[model samples]
Target: MKAWFKSGAPWVWLNGGAVALCMIMVVGLLGLIAVRGFGHFWPADLVQMSVLDRDGDRQEVLGELVRKEVIPARVARTNGYTVAEDVPLVTRYLIKQGNRDLGSDFQWYLDVGMGEWHYPENAIVVERREWGNFYGFPVALKEHGEVISRLGDEDFWPEVEARVERSVDLHNEIRRKEKVEIGSINHKLERLRLERRRLELQGVSPEEMAQAEEQFAVEREALNEEYRRIKAERDAIYEQIERDSFDVETVNGMEKTIHLHNIVRVTRSNHLGVFGKLAHYMDRFWEFLTEEPREANTEGGIFPAIFGTVTMVIVMSIMVTPLGVLAAIYLREYARQGTVLKLIRISVYNLAGVPSIVYGVFGLGFFVYFLGGSIDELFFPASLPAPTFGTPGLFWASLTLALLTLPVVIVSTEEGLARIPSTIRQGSLALGATKSETLWKVVVPLATPGMMTGLILAIARAAGEVAPLMLVGVVKLAPSLPIDGNYPYIHLDQKIMHLGFHIYDVGFQSPNVEAARPLVYATALTLVLLIIILNLTAIKIRNTLREKYRSASD
Candidate 1:
């Protein structure tokens, strides 16, 4: 044992154990998150039960069981609940009775006061475009406010499904028209206004200005014509959606008509087989990936946050790579190796340790205010006082993240450059190559893998950053994507959503805590997957470059 300790075997074993423990911890944490989040998509059976209300009367409740926990009996008693004197613990439930049907989002009930639980086969669970979910029993299918079919009729469920499918298609069509087609028209009209202002700022002659206005008027008239046509079509769709609705009866016998247009999903999971449950799960997960968020980000999908996160990371990577590589090349290969260079390198290293929020503050002040304000004053003066570029936006956010991650890149690239054998440079010089040629063609190529390593690290950090993004560009919701059919398609001036910020918003800022909890886990898992994918891509490129260079050298 003493010899083994002296040989460093004991230390090696300790290190290995530490690594294995860390791996277990990471896997365990991921497993917990996955179980909690991914299960949220699976259809849970509707539960019907009776619980003692605040007034000591038994009231029927129907919905999904969110969670249950045991608490001290004293805690329950303190909340104005009656408990037996001998009971030491009380079990309580957080029942998601649903807002649209129960007039409550969720309620806490003690198990002692609850009656027997019933998994009702006839219960219906509804996911809507707004107002969260509705849990009730199907009463009848209606058309034009009249009952067309009641339950147990051969055509009742099928007809309801058909109408729902039709409504969904119409809703998607109207959304496309509003968000894409008419949105494009509005963007173009704004461009025309800006262009005219630009020409005016340049002090164009009256003839030129009048000619521009004539062309602009023609285009504007055409856009308005198209806009009106789209609006009329959407209005027709709206009428069609309103034509179908279904009546639902709560367990307490309260009836309400739910418009088909408002419904996004309908589930009767009590009869779902294994495959049926799997299909339902996949459908919900896909919708969560593809749909836009609704209802304070407590419902629907997080596609915007995903898109924005990827876009910001890509933009940040693009801005950082060349700048970091160039700085590293200049510092390691060209700059004088003296005290001043040492100071500069130390400053870069120190910048890495600076709190990220400090970078956000600097970016907001310098990049957004000073630099962007100057650009607006000089170039976009036509849109002045409105401050076109003088705002926190995608460009500034990417730039801020680039700055935050610059040191890592510079350090990695410098190490890559330093690793290129001195003999290789001498050989290149002996072959009659200029110093710059040898440095660029030989050294940089050999260092490509190292630069990519830096990029992977930068992307991982930039993609998860929330604090800096909040000050720079991230918002709880963005009206539209930064990239669209508009000219200058990548609108760097636009605000964007990010998965990290989305998690923060859903977990903390959401009005519905229980609804947002699972979403937080799901979004967190998504972010982890995204970062993994990005890092894997970079690693693949780096490995390819390293192999190519190694084979060439051999």
Candidate 2:
């Protein structure tokens, strides 16, 4: 043992064990998140049971069994629950009885209060737009407020499915017309309005101002006509969609009529086979990735958040790479090795260690309030009260993140530059190459891989950062994406959605804790995947560059 300690074998083993433990922890954490998040989409069997209520009356309860936990009888009693002295442990169940519009969607029941429970084949799970979900039994299907088919009829389900499919199609068409076509027209009208205002502010000649106003009026009139046409079409679709309704009887014996237009999907969870459930899971997972969120972001897809995160990271990378490379070159190649240089290096290193929230504060004060306000004053004076760029937005967010990650790039590039031997420079100079040419063509090329490594690190940090983003560009819900079919295409002045902020909002800020819990896990997993993809892309580029430069150096 003493010989092993002297030979440093013990230290090596300790280090290996530490690394293995870290890997195991990371994998375990990811596995847990994946299981919890992905399992949310799977169709679980619905249960129907009779339970004794607080008043000792038996009530019918219908819902999906979400979770079960065992609690000490003492703890249960402390929480005002009745527990037998002989019962040392009590089992409790969390039931998802989603009908938020009517009442609480989730409820807990003690095992002692529950009677026989069984899966009901006729029980249906209705996914809706406003409320979380509806659990009931189908009574009848109606069209134009008249009963068209009764639930006992063999053709009832087929007719309901057909009408529901039609409703979904009409809803999608209405959304496209309203959000895409009419939205684009409105965007153009707004731009024209801004342009006319800009012309007035610029003190253009009266003739030019009149021409601009005339053009704006023509465009505005055309857009309004288009909007009216689309509205009429949407109204027609809505009329068709609202013609169909279904009556469902709840567990408490209350019958309610739900319009087909309001329903997103209906599942017979208890009746589904393995393959059917798998298909349902895949469909739901796809929707979660592609659709816009609803119900306080507790339901629906995170496509906008994904797009914003990628765009911001790309923009930040573009801004940081050049600036960091140039600064590193000036510091390492041209600047005198003096006290000022040493101080600058120290400052850069210290900046990296500062709390990220401090960077957010600096970004808000300097970028949004100071620099952005100045730009608004100078360039966008016409959009005055609105304060165009004088608010937190994508551009300012990207720039802020660029500043936050700049030190890493500079340090990495400088180290790479320092690694190139003095003889390489001497040889280049001997071959009659100018200092600038040698630095750019030879030194920078060799340093590209290191610069990319720094970028990978920067992207990983920036992509997962929520604190700075929340203060800069991220919003709980953005009305529209930053990029669209507008003339400029990409709107840098718009706030964006981010997965990190989405996770934060769903996990902490949402009102429905049970509904938001799985979403938190899903969004967190997605953010991790996104960071991995970005880092992998950067690593690929670095590897290619490193290989190219290695051959050159040889």
Candidate 3:
């Protein structure tokens, strides 16, 4: 054993075991996230069970079994529940009885009191636009105050499905007209107003001002006409959606009228076969990826967040790559090897260790308040008080992140430059190549792959950053995406949604904790996947560069 230790076999085994353990942990965590996140989209069979309270009153519970908890008997007793002293542990169930409109939310029941469980084939889960989900059974469908169809009728299910699909299409149409087309008109009108204000502030001649006003009036009148037409079209679709309604009966026997317009999905969990459930899951997962957030971001899709995150990272990469590469080149290739260089490198390294929130503070103060405010005062005086570029926004957020990740890029690139064999440079110079030619053509190309390594790290860090982003531009909910139909298309001045902040908001700031839990997992998984995709793309490019420059490595 002593000889084995001296031979370093034990140390090698220890290191190998440590690495294996880490890999296992990482894979296990990713697997857990996948199951918890994707499983939320599946249409779980709703269960009906009898639950008894401390008052000895039994109630019929119906909804999806969301969670189960096992607690020590003393803990349960402390929560004001009466249990036998002999029982050391108490099990409880949390049912998502999500009839929020009916003054119902998720409810917990003691496991000791639960009697019989049932999964009714007729029970349906109604995903709604407002007030959360509705767990009940459809009894009848109504149209314009008339009973169009009754449940159990042969055509009822088919009719309901058809109408729901119609509602969805109509809803999308109305939203596009209102939020997209109409919104574009509104944006144009605002820009016109700002332009006129700028002219007034500029002290333009009366004739010139009058000419500008005439042009503005023509454009404004055209926009208004289009807006009116689109608004009318949207209202007509809205009316169609409101025309259909359904009567639902809850487990407690109370009847409620739910308008078809208010619902997003209707799923018959128990009756759905494997194929049906898979289709439903695909539909739900697609919606989660493509739709805008609703219900304080606890429900609906996070398309906006995804778009904003990708856009910001791209913008940050654009800003940082040149800056980081230039700095690294100067430091590594041109700078004198002196104490000053050593201190500069140390400062760059220390910058990476600074608390991320501190960068947020610096960004807010220097970038937003100082630089942005100056830009607004100099070029956008007419939009001054309103701030324009003076506010925290996408541009400032990206710039802030670029600053935060600058060190990673510099260090990685500098190392890459150092790895170039001195013999390569000597040969280039000996072959009558100029110093600049040797450095740029021979050294830089070889270092491209290493620079990409830095970029991957920078992109990964920038994408997940929330603290600095929140101070600079990220919002709990952005009213509009940074990119739109407006000229200059990508609005750097606009606020944006980020997946990291979305996770934090849904997990901690949401009003409904239970609802937020599943969403948190889903958003987290999305962020992880996004990072993986971005890193893979960078890695692919790096590998390609390495292949092209294989002689450098050799």
Candidate 4:
């Protein structure tokens, strides 16, 4: 037994080490992502705070904060948080008591105004003067604990709801006034039109007729002026409605209303009381990769990134498959061993070695600048100096990646074609099968698994690529979605968001670096998971093909 073990020991050791290394790498990546990215979904206790200004224009505040000791089973009547049901079992278990909707749970803000620093330990905020805050207008809260639990009470939330409703009523009143003014303007304009008709038919002297026409024009101008004012007034009222809402919290079982503007700092779960902090971590783990992109930070959803990556892959596959297969067929079957074939092989091999960034530069110059510039000049003359094709976008970026990965597809297909036993082709020819049919029916099927393997590698590499995409398609912030309602509707030229780019933007471009670091890790984890999903899909295809063709290949 020892002798037999020794004989197979080298192979066992090599395989075991490889497996261990792969496991370690995967575990380390997931751990980092869990700690940083998904970990942010938990709730923290609200810290009642107060601020004092040197001038003291507005002062004095008192309120009692009320909260629940245990989270209710059905706190929300509507849909709860967007946690995926498909995540690891452990993640599901941890999130049982976590925040149902993370967005409404956690709260943080900052204040740096003129005065000696007055950082009160825990102060109940009774009323807010304005909606502005250090954490911007919006904030998040946790599901459980005193603050969020108390939020469920009708008495606790009635004032905030009332304020919002009052603001809305004010806006509606302003709109009603504007509508009346507009109606008056329209009536006057209609009367002027009738007067103009009468003047035209009266056969008055030309000079008098012209003067009356001028008076009518003056009335029309007055109508336009009044309408503009009405619109402006409506807009102002709408803005007022948006400025009235804010977040509330309970600290030490006391209800405290922190005015948005008075908020001075934002701390993570560390400052949240024990259970509140635990809930935060639990939510982070539970959310994992399942939440829709819409639920992400103000930066935007991960959906766009997911869509862009998948769309690019599908487009690249559609484009490269035919070209690659054709090139492979010619090289393996039609082309004889000669200088041309040898040169072609060398070029294909060399193309694979070129850096991906170079392809991006080439794509930007040729597809974007040259071809796209020409198209823009002919069709989109109205939107000048901003050529659609000349700018970086998904269409051009996908094309660039397709070019970069083309060699891999061709090489794989050629290898697959080469592996077909000559006897099969000979037998097909002997049985009156033409070369085309022989290649299609006999060779292609057997080679599918290998070709699929190549495609998988290409997708894995392309999905993770960021540097090349940066030059051609990625944008820091996209106000409108990539696909929008506009002329030539597809809008392939529009820049899109991506997870990799999101990581870069948050990590490097953010004004609050310390606050954004965790976000960067979360984005990175999302990108990594996206790439893994793509690879897994490709692997599934490869497996299916392998199963289908196993008997034939054997």
Using TM-score as the measure, which candidate wins? 1
> Residue-wise lDDT of candidate 2 within 101-182, one digit each (tens)?
8888998888877889999899999999888799989999998889989978989988988888888899999999888998
lDDT for every model? 0.92, 0.90, 0.92, 0.60
lDDT of 1 by residue, 356-416 (tens): 9999999999999999999999888989889878999999999999999999999999999
Could you give the candidate ranking by TM-score, starting with the highest?
Answer: 1, 3, 2, 4
Candidate 2 Cα misplacement greater than 4 A, ranges: 74-82, 205-208, 552-554
Give the runs in model 3 whose Cα sits over 4 Å from its true position. Answer: 74-82, 551-554
Off by over 4 Å in 4: 1-8, 46-154, 158-240, 246-300, 378-385, 485-489, 549-554
Measured by C-alpha RMSD in angstroms, how accurate is candidate 1? 1.3
The superposed Cα distance between candidate 4 and the true structure at residue 220, in angstroms, equals 20
Question: Per-residue CA lDDT of candidate 3, range 1-554, in tens?
Answer: 88988999999999999999999999999889888988999999999988877677888888888889998999878877778999999889888899887765888788877788989999999899999998889999999879999998999999999998888888888888878898888888988999999899989999999999899999999999998888888888888999999899999899999898888989999999999999999999999999999999989999999999999999999999999999999999899999999999999999999999999999999999999999999988887699978899999999999999999999999999999999999999999999999988889999998899999999999999999998999999998899988898989999999999999999999989988888888899999999999999999999999998886556
**TM agreement with the true structure for every prediction:** 0.98, 0.96, 0.97, 0.62
Candidate 4 per-residue C-alpha lDDT over 1-554 given as tens digits, one digit per residue, 9 for 90 to 100 = 88967799878998999999999998997898867666545443222234222333422222111122332223211124222344221111111111212222222111212123232333222212222112111122222222332433555345543554465467546646654566556657755775675566567899998899788778789888988888788778666654543454432222233422222123332235677567645644443343333222322235666566677777777777778888888898999999989999999999999998899889888988898898877765444565657788888877888888889989988988888899989999999999999988888888887788778778877777777888888776654445533334466787776677777777777754544556677778877777788888888988888788887657
Clashing pairs in 2: none
Q: What value does the lDDT take at residue 321 in candidate 1?
A: 100
